[model samples]
Target: MTLNRPDVFGSISLMFWSIVIVVCIKYLGFITRADNDGEGGILALAHLTRSSLREGSRRYALVMILGVIGASLFYGDSLLTPSISVLSAVEGIEVAIPSLSHVVLELGVLIIVGLFVVQRHGTEKVGKSFGPIMIVWFVTLAAMGLTHIAEDPSILAALSPHYGMLFIAEHPFIAFVASGAIVLVITGTEALYADMGHLGRPAIATAWFGLVFPALTLNYLGQGAMILNHPETVSNPFFKMAPDWGQIPLVLLSTMATVIASQAVISGVYSVSRQAERLGYLPRLTVRQTSAHTGGQIYVPAVNWLVFAGVLALMLTFGESSRLATAYGVAVTATFILTTVLFCVYASSALGWKPWQVLLAGGLFGVIELAFFAANVTKVFHGGWLPILVALLLSTVMLTWQRGVVLVTARRTKLEGPLTEYLSSDAVVNVKRIPGSAVFLHPSKQTVPLALRENVHFNQVLHNNVVIVTTRSLNVPHVDDSERVTIDHLASEYDRITHVQLDYGFSDHQDVPAGLKVAAERHGVELDIENATYFISRITLRISDRPGMARWRKGIVRGLAQNAARPSDYFHLPIDRTVLMGAEVNF
Candidate 1:
């Protein structure tokens, strides 16, 4: 957008240095090292820090608030990335044929809908081609940039940090404003750490250092060189890098690259949403495994369609990339800031980094990201409010759900009472015992299953054999089978009533029936897998004069709980053999 040669050089320098400092140094060198059991991401980083920080400390509270804010902003990034990416790539049509500009939005929407539609089929087949396609895209980017740089070698001066400083010193306000747009260069940098669970750090670092980094550097330099040589091409310098005959092919390739990028972001939303659900920050939703061979290759239909609706609305409302760009930087830069803060916490608390090291590293990235965030803040009235609004809404939902769960769990624990006491109580001693086995799924093994209590109280009968299954979701990515199931005979007097704890990682599949079968086989727990009637507690939450949370927040939690997926479906239990016992609980 800057037509002046000096402005172009300064902007190029700003972007180049951002890549070096924010991405190459901070993320690749520092942030990626702070993994939660080989997993990386904002939430993973939070998980790592939460382990070291005292639970009720102020710092712990800060990390948690930042983590939720970071995660919420991620949804904003997920929504905007696809909209802006597809729109920007499709806008290339305007450069190739100006008369076709009108169809850009139509084409973009079509491509977006098609991309989301195919998500149900899983990315296994199409994902095989992503690496090759991206490699070609990067090569093309480098080649095109090399040609332009050769034409105007003066643009290479942008490699020095002085130009960026010079730009800021000369035009303070303009530089601050330009920082907002410049942040886009490092937009997808978070994914490097976020996807470490799926693709390890070594592979990601190698890919970055070997191919992605060099390609991006050359491409940015080439765009600057081309803009310098032909100032009139400033409006669409990327497409202008190609020859007239190659323009169409370049456009086609750009569209595919954006589609691949969008796919990654969409999948990330699903992964983080699942993580949130497991961590008790969100209600359970139906998760479908699209690839039987690959555990991470799963899809959430509700998230897929909800995001599509948002992306469609953004494309229709914004109408072009430039306008959408205003909304994009706020969420991304905010997330960058959150990640930096969390990393500093992890470094100091977990990694045992000295104060100076932590401060120096954190302050550098914090200032840089904060500047970008402040710059984007100026565009709030224009379109920046969209992401901030999205982040606020999602954060509220997460926090409310978490608070509601705590209150309800506490109340339910009192009502259910201790399992040991209940098993030895006079009521249980006089209860008529049935012949068949009954399995009850509860969140805690220490407490009596609510459904079990209800069944004995109202029906006046108890199963001869009872199994209490508690699925515990740990913060790690995967748990070994050796530690998966722990069998505890609650009482030798009532050996028929056994307690089984099934441990799972956040990424692990939550299949209760399958876990029960494994427990029966591996741990010698007694249970009829096919014939046992699985009992689930369907707790009905009602608002009361509770001292926990605000009335409005409680209502939101109730709505979310009401809309959550059925426990049987989520736990992969057989519907025909499952029974739900309803009970009222006030919060």
Candidate 2:
């Protein structure tokens, strides 16, 4: 009966599966990295934590602590993964020619430098070429694996539920540890979800299930076959599977792919940093335009230089892929687990699903993720300290920036009276009339910012029309221009306002004044950008011995603020029309 069955079914099934693999491969990596401000990675996860939970809620505090911790660990993963991915591929060269080992490290460094230098060109041009190159890479992997699979048909047995189950049963601890190593195969898979807004969910899902999964599975199985067939070659099964002549091209391709992975992460850092600044967790940094079309395609000079330095340090110190592997999984796995938890919360609150329903559905996924996380944690005593150290340093900086901004804002607000009080007071009423509308730019929603109060005491004169401009961001990117800016009347003469924020996906520049003008016109306000005066309060922070945070943290906070970009420039306020009220404030 089996022999009489048509071969057409098998042919059609193979064709269907092939299509699925191709689609998955195209978008899997990109999807895993998408997040706020057109960036994805640990920092994006941190932003998610702050944005999702209420400040006063117990869940907010808990999620914040957990998110930061997870984000810090993700930094570790970012540092180590490049080294592993590149070195493992380069090491394949050693199989073809043993003498290349002495020079491989130098080659690796060259590849990393070249990768970062080209980032200014924007990923769109390079990314277009990536799909084709990845196609070749996957095809090569599949071909190599197929050749070996022919030798021992039983090697396919590993795909069976029984082999995996039996392997775990026999050596649970070893299997757990091995799972960490294997998980590297799907390292950037989450980018598929994070980048959903960029590539769209259907594209990413199709890419993973179709092309990427099959190619990766084939390559991994080929490596497994090499290990099983020649037990002595277990030291580096990937290299053993490659033919002598194919090793050089494989090495080059692998190095290229690793560089691509690092580029994704570094770009992610820039996006997340900008988002954090907007969310009030980070100080604004000078974000330089890298591309004209993509608002998300920005180059943060400070972050870029810092990441380049860190990558170099990591390459120099680790020197080998095996050693770097120790640090790879811990951070990213932790982030994955944290994301699941956050997603559960988001599903419940934002999606308006039943709490029990979300908990049940998300909880299953969480359990599997945590198991993987635990495996990564087991690797901590090894060279994992590398990523942990990097993450801790980053988290410290993030937390300090957040705390310092809060304290400084609070101190500034203390000096100002309520809007109703200020408008009714003799001080505002007695002021000389000015020609145009006077807009006061305050940092918070409270009565008066301390910097504004200092400026008011010195200037003493109020303008004819008073407008307090406050900018707000929605969780999603790219709001309609009509909804971008909203003006609400708070009291008789007092106005409360908000803005609809728009960000182009990671490849365009943001023009705040132009955007505001467009939005205002759409909302029926004749905004005269040419004649309007923009007022900004510049706070100069003074270091004090007042007890608040650790001395080191205080120093870090001061340095971050000092190095931050001036608000006028960051917000794209017109230099020709803007005036700064500089005042010294204590934190």
Candidate 3:
């Protein structure tokens, strides 16, 4: 930013106003109110809005696309944030010990690597210390900034709307450019909403207003005051604010805080990926529950490694935090803009807001976010293109996986026909019955299980008791254990066939065997837990080079299906008792 030599007053004004408008108002005021059950985030909000709309409607598809795009943008932010935050903090070594500056990049990369490696073990152990560390960190920031504020008391005047308006009015172009950097102050504001399910709105609000908001304000103000006294220090005012002795400790503290900060986003990436799989926008990956007591405590090795690789590439290519800064605001602002648009959809579809009311709220928020987005647009040519490219690639992958599921499901349904029609057919009634129970996992109870049909087609012997289990993920956060799972006695014919439908919210943990046990107990079915063989149809997708998608897309979609984790592991089934039936599908 010093390269541009923009006015300090304009930059400072824009910075404070951004925190107030974007963080304090736009998110807290409107966005967080539209959570899906107790969960809140762009993906959760997308599910909430879609839940209100009729299935197969245009609005539902539109909301799903926007949700997927918002999630992809989050992936971009997750990659860029850790690199920039850690690098920026490590650069403070130059302030504490000028001679040690040469090792800053190496140290930054090392710290980031350590951060990623510990991710698989999960945050359960160190997470207890995070609260205390951040509390001390924020208090230190406030104390540091409060002492410096006495140096130039006038810096407080930037808080007024007048200064912000005047700065924008007098220097429109510079204020526009300043907004791109000012956005750095509010980078993690979305976390407030994303984590609402974990902490709840009341706790998040209490922490934000009672501690975070004040601490951040004081620290940024102190930096402004220090820069006011010595304008030459504008290059890195944050580190320059501390005295010689305090600089080293501050640098160490900053590094720790940045690591903690990066951990939050990495955890967010894991959560969004889980939701994507649950909603069928992605293939089921290996989800290891890091905490046995906490259902949401999950870690994905694939997502972790991919994110680390992306972060490393970003650090190496950008070389400095300043260059990476140009890439930051684009993804954050784009996500914010989309969230605002999605909220408007929710306000109308769910809340039944009038047109004027929606316009007054959403239009105001949209125009502000659009301005921030436009300011960020000026940076695309200046190394800001990375996140955009990342987002595009992710969006393509998500769309491909989603489209592939539809095609595969359609093909299967057409081949097997409905469950009712098939069960009532002459062949099922007279087929030779074998011993032991066979449980088949299917997507829908109304559709015939491909594994069952194929099993009977080849072997020509049906199990004496064949149980078809269809698991569904709903749009809310959790499902009560008692309401949904049931064994369809009437649907069962020849006293050997039964249908079990298990329903869960997207955020719920799914255990097929456990659910079946409950269903079996309630229905008075004599079930042997270990003796039952769980069957799953393993699909090998081929490139049909269909009309809807290009040949390359078809190949990519096929690769995703072929590489996905096996259904047994994904669903937490007993490995020894599971049987997978393979089939080829060219679509």
Regions of candidate 2 where Cα sits further than 4 Å from its true position: 1-57, 190-198, 228-235, 287-299, 340-378, 434-440, 443-456, 462-468, 473-533, 543-552, 574-577
RMSD of each: 2.4, 6.9, 3.0
Q: Indicate the worst ten consecutive residues by lDDT in candidate 2.
A: 1-10
2 or 3, greater by lDDT: 3
Tens-digit per-residue lDDT, 450-485, candidate 2: 444554567765555545666654444355555555
RMSD of 1: 2.4
Q: Which structure among the candidates has the greatest lDDT?
A: 1
Q: Let me know the TM-score candidate 3 reaches against the reference structure.
A: 0.92
lDDT of 1 by residue, 1-587 (tens): 44777888888889989999998899999888887666677887887788899989999877877888998998988889999999999999888888999899999999999999988876566577688999999999999999999998888888888988999999999899888889889998776667665557887789888998899989999999887778788778899889999999999999999999898788778777776886689998888766544445568888999999999999999889988887778888989999998988889998899999999998899999999999988888888889889999999999899989999999988898998888888888789988888999987778888899999999999888889988887756578778899888875634588888998865677888888888889888878888999999999999998798999999999999998988887788889999999999998
lDDT of 3 by residue, 65-178 (tens): 999999898899999989999999999998889899889889999999999998878656556767788888899999888988888787787676677778788778877777
Which is better, 1 or 3, measured by TM-score? 1
C-alpha-based local distance difference test score of model 3: 0.81
What's the TM-score of every candidate structure?
Answer: 0.94, 0.79, 0.92
- Stretches of candidate 1 off by over 4 Å are 1-6, 289-297, 473-484, 493-495, 503-510, 518-524
Cα-based lDDT at residue 415, candidate 3: 71
